[model samples]
Target: MSYNSRTIDLILKAQEPNQKQFTTFQQFFKSNNPPPLLFEKNITPKNVKAQRSFSNKTQDSIKETKRKSLSQLKYPEYRMLKIYARIKPGECQLNYDKQSILIETNPYNFDRVFEQSATQGDIFDIVAKQTVDDFLNNINGCLIAYGQTGSGKTFTMFGESSNPGIVLRTFTHLFSRNQETIYVSILEIYKDHVYDLVSGVQDLKLKEDLQLGFYVDGLKKIKVDKLESCQELLQIAEENRHVAETKLNALSSRSHLILTIQMGKTKLHLVDLAGSEKVNKTGAIGETLQEAKKINYSLSCLGHVIQCLSQGQDHIPYRDSKLTKLLMDSLQADCRTSIIVTLSPESKNQDETVSSLKFAQRARFIKKEIRIATQKKTYRDLELEITQLKQELLETKQRMSQTSSVSQFQCRYTTDSEIPCTESLRLTYRSMTNENKENYLPNLKTQENNTQLELENKINQILVELQGLNKEQSLDNVKRQVAKINELTIDMKKTYKVLVSTQGLNNNQLQIQSQFIETQQEQNKQLQKIAEQISSMDSSKPSFNIAINNMIKNLQQQQKQNIEDMQSKLEKVYYDIKKNTTVQDYNLNHLALKLVASPNRQQQQQQQQQIKRSQSKTNINPSVKYLKNKK
Candidate 1:
């Protein structure tokens, strides 16, 4: 039959009411048989209930991996933070409509909203009481306050003069509760530099150890067994804190301050972060601008770390800033942290308020893996450990000695002369026994003496070489000293030459002055002689008298001219000496002043001697009298 005719007949027969059964041989050719199936198919049952069941299991697995339950742990666990909003007084207010908008913001939600009337005590009671209790119970806890500039963040965390804040209240409570040893360490991170507030170390470092997770390397820890002591330390630290005047806040903190209180193994960290101020809004410039940028950068790094933790990200960059690095242990997966977000009611601070709220919101999702700090071993415990270790060591030694092969193989020592051969050493060691220890000891002593002698000989040789080196060094030192002496001698010779030149100049000046003085005396004597001659002439010779008067006038004119010429000569000599002194590389200005004030001590003495001689030779007054008498 044709393939098309057989297929059409089979289809038509299958549609009939009663189809006859075909025999095995005719089944293939029967026209009433249904068409042959092209391929076999396996059908799966569609059960919506079973599919939903599998989908739920897959979701549960994902959820379990995403976040494990902390409730199952026996140790203390960290709780998610709830927001607390307190609008500061005397500040701008958010409008009713804006308030509604802010409340509607999903991430800006808070557990408690306090109006402008909330007190410091109320805020502390709500935020810090539980943390205090946890701290007392030997659990580490942290309470941090964050907000905008001039939002009263420090005032709220530390309080003003009249109002006491959480820190004081916590101190009072701890003191009242019992006598506990409290160690306080206060530090600040300013402009990316870590500083100790209590110790005044401007630049400090952070160190991490296996036991203490992260600590400031050179931070000062003060032990305060009394409340007064705690107060004193707090006051000192506050005095040391870095504060600056900003346009936004009068006493604006320029750094992040962290105060850690340790009681035995438990600790409590109270951090007050510098307010978040915008560069433009705060009107920050220069140093203030730089500080603002660093503060913002560190806060941003902190925010990034929190965001990563909230979203279950693998990597958290804690090493981005010094503040975050120091706070690594407090912000890690094993800390109990609480953040108090302080806000300003001012509409101008709306952006900062929103930022702070969002920061606290992200922090709410962080579930730190909490565990108690390991306690240090006591004296008794240490002593027990030492005893146990000693016993174990003895046991090990005895076992080693029992195993002859092991002992012999491991036992090896070197002698002064012999080459180090392990096989020979082992043979020698095995040959010695307890009974022969006497003989072995003597041989060991002899070998030790030989080694000592060799060492002594080597040391003597080294000493001799060192002595030779020292002698050579001494000779070199002597040569250096001689060279230095020669250099000093040359300098002294130059100085002496300058002195000789100055003396010669002074002597020339003195000689010139003496000569001028002598000339003046001679002129006086000649004037006396002329006057006497003029007076002695008879009045009858009127012409002769007039001629004599003319002669006297000429002589006086010559004396005036001679004095002027001497003055000119003195000025020339002075200028020449100045130029020569300068060329000789001496300080001529000072020397010139000295010369003008008093030419020279020796020159003055010579001038006085010359004046005495002139006075003795020509008594000018007596000569004038004698000439008048003769006339």
Candidate 2:
């Protein structure tokens, strides 16, 4: 048999099923008297063209199916799917506008579509601002970024360079609008293992709390004061995140990163999912391959959950995967959610892009039952706030009183004619006091010092009684003490007001009056100190109460004596003024007597006793005349 060169080549290239066929081919090729073989034409130009056309049509059909699968999704019409087309590596053509992406014959519709050229600011305004607003209104919100490996999921959620991403912007807006404390926690889920990125807790467990829902056990939650603080933490978490090199991406995150922002009762979850990728394409090996499988499985479980939620299925497989379990609370029907599905425009990543779109579509059908978290303030917090405000008010009032007193004193001395005091008498008294400081200062000082000792003894007795009262720790006793303190404070204020009104004296009288005023101020200070200590007392620390009680009782007794002594001195001065009508200013004397006569009932009882004893020694008719003239 003779064989053509083409036939021989075909026979050599084709594998033989049996040894007989191979032996026959070898014998035919070696023989010179080979059979003449006519070569059969297996391929024609027309057939080749037809096959190429079939291949083209089949690809078109596949592309059309992918487009229709996303576009023809029968999800809930109330919520729109937000899709962003990220320019993948080696992508040349931009098939996306600001609103939608064109995929062959069908357009993948979205609420808003961001192209490769879109800025972080643009994305923040379109997507994040609304979420921040919802958060401000106490709405439970979840914003998630999902895509394939190297699809810019992290960059979208947390941007690079100076352009801030959604999480930072949300914090900035939240703090700017409301100055409430913001709490933050960062964690990553890998291979069904949860780890704290902030505190470096390894193998953190997911715990289902009845009150807090699903939370990572032992996760470190930090109280953030400013946007810069949160940004710093985010950087730290990024450094601590589980990431490694892969065939698909040089620095691919191997775990799902969940950033939770707690604002009072409302919680905002910014989740950046590990991009779904093909195990074969990623070329993962050993532990990397295992992690990739876990990532893919958890992500697939999330999709299944979304589908079940969209279909209103009862048996939604939330507990099937750790990722889904963590998201179960945030993805509920009542939560406000937004999913940013990143895509690649490159033809090479078409498969991943289609899969991501399908997942995003499934998420869009889920009807989130939008609910705002109800914030409730505990009784203790409210009580603390009230106490804080009261302290502030008291301090402010003290400051105002000091300022007003200084202003009044300056006004009285600067223009003596406007007040009841004669300017010459004032100068004379100023000179006398300056010269005779040793005489006046020491005498009053010694008296005040001695009064302090006696007052201290009485205060010690009061404190012993107070200690006994406090030992009961009964609410009724606390209420009674508070009421008693309030009554005492009111009486002190009244006495101080009466003393303040008795101003406008000559220089000599002013010196005496200032000494009295100084004594009253000291008493007021003691009262304030005691009141503050009582107000700030903590029931848990009984030692503080006993110490404050012991320290202030003597001061309280001294203040009571000082007030009585001041009234007595005022009455004596009035009698002296009545005896000496030769004094410079009759108006001053009249004003002083009128102020002394009009004391509150607490002072009246003491004054009445002093009046009966003084009636025989001094005629009251002149003082009564001074009071009537003043009126």
Candidate 3:
């Protein structure tokens, strides 16, 4: 009479078929032969219907837990999509007099709206800063730039050296923290087919798991290190991305490029979508015509998915297009999504602008359910990953053995000394993995930046009063970059002189001004030494000047208070001595002259002449030179 545990569990689950678990065992007893579970027995329900039911559940509010591990938030709430609008600077081309103009009088608002004058820093600080902070806690995030063709979508996502875009800015911010071990994969969806940008692998496969969502298969993953390395990688991806000349744009992106940043189990996606356009306006023909059709179709599908999610449809057609399917997790209730919709004020594209606004408005209503289970992998998936990693390790060893020419000394046009030779004598410092000058760098950079830490400690020692100043909040624009010798020296000199004044005395507060001014001439020499040390070690840190500036400010205030206190104490001591003592004076008091007071005046003159200059101030004074103890 042994009962199988599986049967008992299934019977219990069948009692409350709709619930996550059985509510009562009494229903199991009523049926001696209970039916098996409808789909499959799984710890996490895999049925599409079950997933829908959970998604539809109305929660009162986002619930917070008392405690959790791994990530700070185990159950981050399914938040609404964070959407923004960026208005590119241009004259209103839409004719106000024309009745046929497509423009909304009362347009939909968003979480944040950027004006035409907004800088790249402004966009990042408001949108991506908090997400990056959360990323360190292991929460996944996604940033998507959506807009019409030539509407500054790519420009907003990736900017120039003078003003870095979100992608470059993100890399700088992420690496500056020195926390996560991040890897990168770049891919583009062109003509509804995925292609790896880095490895130039064409037509990669899209794999989907019931719970884990969709991911591209066979894409090469590159390890990311310094900010320069990220820039190089991004350059390669951009070069590989599909682009063409159009009537409206000189260089137009024809594909949707997605950069996936992998850190352990967490992933952050940076998607730059091709702008939507009117085929008539674009004058797209031939191959460009076909690309336009696919791009428009994909964007429309995205809009449709948003429409469905807003209406709470039972079957959202996520599988309708590759673009939607690939970005499913980002749009759905799992990954945190932030959308920057770029808009052109031109009258020609007013219709597209209105449509984009509507799409974003609907997208704002979609909420992502942040369950405790951020780990998208299942046991079977882990097993497969293990197998894959082992295969990768095997392949690595095979490649290492095969790449003997690369690992060992090989033929070159010239020797290391620029001598004409066929073979190089130098051993390869790089392993099978790709490397540059940075690879041979110190293992110390593997952790935190020692140079930054040491600089901070030195600053902390110098300005002890400002120890409470938040280390996290680095004062911006207060001082120039440490690398900028001229600017930094000027900024530091001004900040340093705040404590000094003009009155002349060695220790006098007023005289301190001249001392500081004199030192200003040599300021460049000292600044160069500091900048060289800091920049040579880690050029990523620009806070050195800012920290020093703040330190100087605090030190100046502290110096002023100290000078005042010292002056007050000296004055008080002088007055106390004056009140406690007495003094008397006598005209020439020579020992011989005291006895011959009635003698001639010549004797008095002789006594006066004999008097020492030290005693000339006063012949007799009752100043206490020493105090003798009377026992």
lDDT of 3 at 143: 93
- Tens digits of per-residue lDDT for model 2 on 428-475? 223232334233333333333444454455445445444444443333
Pairs clashing within candidate 3: 78-368, 333-368, 503-510
Q: Which prediction has more favorable TM-score, 2 or 3?
A: 3
Q: TM-score for all predictions?
A: 0.47, 0.47, 0.48
Model 2 scores worst on lDDT over the 10 consecutive residues at 35-44
Best by lDDT: 2
State each candidate's clash count: 2, 9, 3
* Runs in model 2 lying further than 4 Å from the true structure: 1-94, 375-631
Model 3 Cα lDDT, one tens digit per residue, 414-501: 3333311111111112111223323322321221134334434544433332221222122222123322333323333332232121
Candidate 3 Cα errors over 4 Å, as ranges: 1-80, 93-104, 376-631
lDDT of 2 at 41: 14
| Model 1, span 331-450: residue lDDT tens | 864456777777787777777877887887787677666454334344344455446545544544443343344223233423322312223222333333445434453444344345
**lDDT assessment of candidate 2:** 0.63
